[model samples]
Target: MPYDFGTWDRNCNAEQSQPLTGTLTGTIPSWLRGSLVCNGPGLMKYGDHEFKHVFDGSAMLQKFTISETGMTYTSKFIKSFAYTTNTEHQQIVVSEFGTRGCSVTKGFLSKLGSKFQFDKMFSDNPPVTLARFGGAYYATTEAPFLHRIDLDTLETGEKVNLHKLLNLNSQCPHPVTLADGATVNVHSAVGPLGPRYEVVKFPPTCPAGADSVFAKPVKLASCETRWKLNPCHMHTFGLTEHYALLPEQPLTVDVTAMVANTIKDKPLIEGMEWLKDKQVKYRILSLETGKELKLKVKSESFFYMHIANCYEEADHLVFDVTTFETPSLLHQFKLENLRTKGSALAGEVDSGCIRRYVVPLNESVKAAPEENLVKLPGAQATAHRQKDGTIFLTSQKLSDVAYENPVVNPAMERKPYNFFYGISGDMTSNKASVGKVNVRTAEVTRWDAPDDVYAASIAFAPRPGATAEDDGVLLVHCVHAERRRVSLWLLSAADLSDIASASFTLATDAPRALHAVYMP
Candidate 1:
């Protein structure tokens, strides 16, 4: 099913490519869009300049220096992202590899020659990896291929064919999604071989007897032109060395009922006509072996969710798990002792903690109307893993849980105005705050920020040679904590009480962002 932008909210004025609904056209506002992109820091060494992109929505370039303190990188931004000390060189650097475009209108609008293009031009769905080397780095702007560049050399290195790398031919949709929900229909053409069978010639075949046969390319008898679009996806896999673990929720289809309900002149139901009432399958995969393993987790479904974050403490894998209707969950899976050959895609081979969290689903909290009680369309959240094992998650918790006009019946207005006002009758802005969870003890804590403060990014910095108690340092981004401005917060790592704060008035205001990359 294709995305329907108008169905979720009529008030949305931004023309979006899909119906993921949260911001305009379900896209993040330009300011807020930048907020979410501030997740991971990149180190690009250019000759004498050690350019580190310290994220706070707008990328801030810093000079990296090494001293007895460990490693220190200074940013021009008000609050600095401090690193203890290291042996890395220090220099000034800038990235031509800046944001392809603001995620707001750039993704949804279909305009040629425009500075922004749909996120589809590049891989936007699954989390992408960005690496930096001396005066250079590697990134993939398109599917089916990966590119590396020597920032100093200005030479494009060898292209790694993702299809060959992952062993999936044209059958896969380039393992990317349109930042907006639009599709470029590519007609099948004869290849040098014959019918142009999608081939995997790069990354060699999977290990013998691996779960390679599980996720057979979904062969549809016909294109999904008529099926009602299901916004929730089962899984969105991020890449790791020698593996691309994809999680998914199965599509429900019923051949008999599909045919009976067909009012169109023609209905195309071929191989998978039997999929009607089947529950969606949610699991993880081992790209090397094509192994599909089910995750013993449940929660609310999401079309757009930040799936993974790097946590050295979590054995490198910390994931946000939630079902469409279930409470939000944070799960940490360590690579230690965990095997991928079995039916249990995930297990407690080691140990981690799960916490119960909620993103308000009421009319007041949702950017759209139909979402009354924690069921908003296209609500996105990100959980950042600090240097320690603790995880900090950003979400909007509504001050009010009930709405005067509940959409229990279809006959009610599909879209509602003044609906938010009614739901927020007694709501407080500061009520929507960021929460912290300790994976070891499963202890939970909340920090109430100003009403306008939307917690966007949370990072950690430990003092040199400091113990757990001494590692009380943090860097937080409040996209709008300071009146549509981007503000940085320095806080106690042990307790999220603010230590210091600095503000930067955006030349242009933005929505609270979801990710950031910190550099010391």
Candidate 2:
């Protein structure tokens, strides 16, 4: 079924900065005193120059502050050099993933004048997901730039160029911030030594008075990748208490193609290719030693963008990740494609499912090719040692429903957790509902949305003095464009029941966001 995602493509208003009061429909927990800050594409067009892809929109920071009185809304376009320059010329000036920045007033959007290379036309649009680089929070894409923002003031602050401090040309957008105030992320560098993928750690910095945390990275654990010129795309990686799990999928980014495409005035995704013959490998980097374990673990090719949860046992390394059997996901989110087929493709859309894979970290043991190495009870996944010294991994589906943006409690991260929450959907339907999955019971629960409404990514916020892992709230952003309204639905994580919904019908520039974080 084709699902129309036109409602999710909302544009920013004329205001540079403004706080709007939103109407509340239900009671907000008095103890829930914080903000749900979201970042995503908020501006799709500039004057006559319209963006060509879904990821090319101007970055905007939208906030929903929860107070004792009621819920309020505010937003600000990230004041990056790209945004300012585009606003100054009233046209698209910087190139993005699938959009070319060209000088054209009235013409085909993709056929604009060019000769804009990737490095020369590099953009500072960090509209994907927001994370703490070190001292402060910054809006981050997969690029080398982090656009800093003040959560309270809705203000864009100093922009940091990450490439200046390290040999990193690009950093993965999903930076996993651990409970100890440290951040674990991966960066890829391509130079004379071919390509080297490194797992980096950013020690927590005092956000109060620290001027710069550029030197906060204590260690860079380099992991070996399969490709040299065309490294696999690293949109996300999994982390455990002891190691960073780096996945090398078959979907690779062709650097030569990207530069060539840019010269031809084409979008960036054109440079990406899916090598069907390649097998996926999960490389382990020991956090304690700050070194790669050099494990030869390979599995059948599968494409993924998010990992739900991961933890390490004495003998096995277990992790849950959203998987797709095909690499067609790369082209599914194009604006033109979404207009027709829409964005309703679920996990099973093409063998898309949440899979839990278990690997035997103790590589010394000898086992037959048919012998399953997983010892945990009720375990369906297998780790069999091949004759070629490769431990092959095979996984079975964990749930029937799709947990696209899988998130676990912050406290339970890098540890064993039973329940995880995310934007869930049915395989036969296009509409999305927030879902919670229980790993032990093999049960899935969901809070479906009303008709004519869209629910975005869901985040797990733990309650104060929480007892259980699911004892908290789930924050999700929903948009009903036909009604000119947006809302924040707070659901009890324990039961998936709606506690309250704060709806804003004031046209307060609340667009559907990519990801959200709950700060209390």
Candidate 3:
């Protein structure tokens, strides 16, 4: 069955406050108590105009509260200034990462005048990640600010600016929480001279100070490069217990081009230039000492959105990531092309695979051949060699499965773990399903939804008092394309079997989610 794009497009409005009353299949777990919150772009169109990129839509927050007796569903749009202002104007006045704003009037003067409206550049649409920090719920994007959401009511709160609070300009949507409750994140800023990245730590509670309404950030590590451009458009970085790995790809950001594009009223995503000749640079920083080591690796020019997990094993640092060969995956998200071309041909979209890269920290006893020992060019480090004198960065292709929105067992994060779960499907197929992969064995188990159903990302809800790593239920958000309904499926993590399901009816179809979180 083909996907109902028209139905999806119509269902992009703000969800009502009423709870979805529906039937429950099987039985609700008596121990289950908490909320599963998912964030994504829900409003694709504004009055007469539609967003050019799928990511340009305003954010929507969907909350599913699981009680002992049953589950209730509700959703609301995050009331960011951008969302409210656009709603009041009945048009997309704010400039998004991929969506440029139309000038209020014609000519170069109007365009230049619009560029001065820096307020329009702030897209508080926190559609990428749903995070809990400092005892508050937050919807975060790649932007510098964090939009607070009330956990009880799912209402949007004030936008917390890290730039104002910590003097950090950009932040990763995904933040790693330590065992002691301290949260760590990476923030990057680009300037005319070059770019710099900082690793910041936040306590579990807000600190004392005028700028400390939220937790105060303590900078642990800082790195600066004089390359005259921001290398890699990084969304997330890898974290281990003792080290943080920053994989700097070749997706160079042209600061001049970005400014020119803004003045020209062009989309900022185009300002990113892919430097095909540059190798991926991994900046390994010691969490304790703040010392940094640069390791250069050779690979085909590729793009990665998220790092699954990273850990230190003796003298080796191992990490797994979802990789893409090019930015063509973005082209596949154009709604106009999807409507005209149809999604059946999307199988040809090869976005790459999940691979693990192992980097050796120890020095190699064997020396490089005289012919191979070339001068270190530019700022690039010579590829580290293994003990056997081979190029040290060894990569293993774990699986051919093309999937994203990956999550591992929460308890096993920053440590060695095996299983990983995510939404799985071919690029062109609308029939998505939940899949689990055993990283150690490359064994994959999947649960496919009905032909008319599409599964969003899966969130692992760890069972209370569970012993084993996989002892939990996988919570999946599913959407019925033609019927225009949505449901949450609770599957057994041991086998991916449907343990229970709760279906609900909505006034409009829910947009596909980018990520979700289970709070228990």
Per-residue accuracy of model 1 over 299-393 as CA lDDT, tens digit each = 23232223322111112223332222221111111111112212132222111222122222111321332222233233233333333322333
Off by over 4 Å in 2: 103-121, 206-211, 340-351, 425-430, 481-483, 508-510
Model 3 RMSD vs true structure: 4.7
Ranking by TM-score: 2, 3, 1
Using lDDT as the measure, the top candidate is 2
| Residue 427 local lDDT, model 3 | 43
| lDDT per residue (tens digit) for residues 1-520 in model 2 | 4344666556665443566677777788777889998888888888888877777888877788888988877777888878887888888877778887765446555443334423345677988878975657889888788888888887889888877667577888989887766787899876567888878887787344445665557665785567888889889988877778888999998988887887687777888899999899888888788787867898888888888888887678888888887767557666777666654544324546788888888755577788888887777888888888889999867786457878888888778779888776453444567778887676888888766567875677888998888888888888774546778888899888888888776554456788888878
Which residue ranges in model 3 land beyond 4 Å of their true spot?
1-11, 103-114, 190-193, 210-215, 225-227, 365-392, 428-430
Our model 1 lands, by Cα RMSD against the true structure, at: 21.0
lDDT of 3 by residue, 1-520 (tens): 5554443343367685887755689887777788888888888777886787778888888888888778888888998877887888778888887788655556887757767564555566788877767767688987787888886788988788766565566788998878777788888865455578888788777777634435556777767742456556778888887788888878766778887878777776778787777667778787888868654434445788888888876666677888877766666666666666665536546646777776666644465533222232221223345443445353566667655788888988878788888776454455676778887876788888767677876799888999898999999987777545778889898899888888887777667777888987
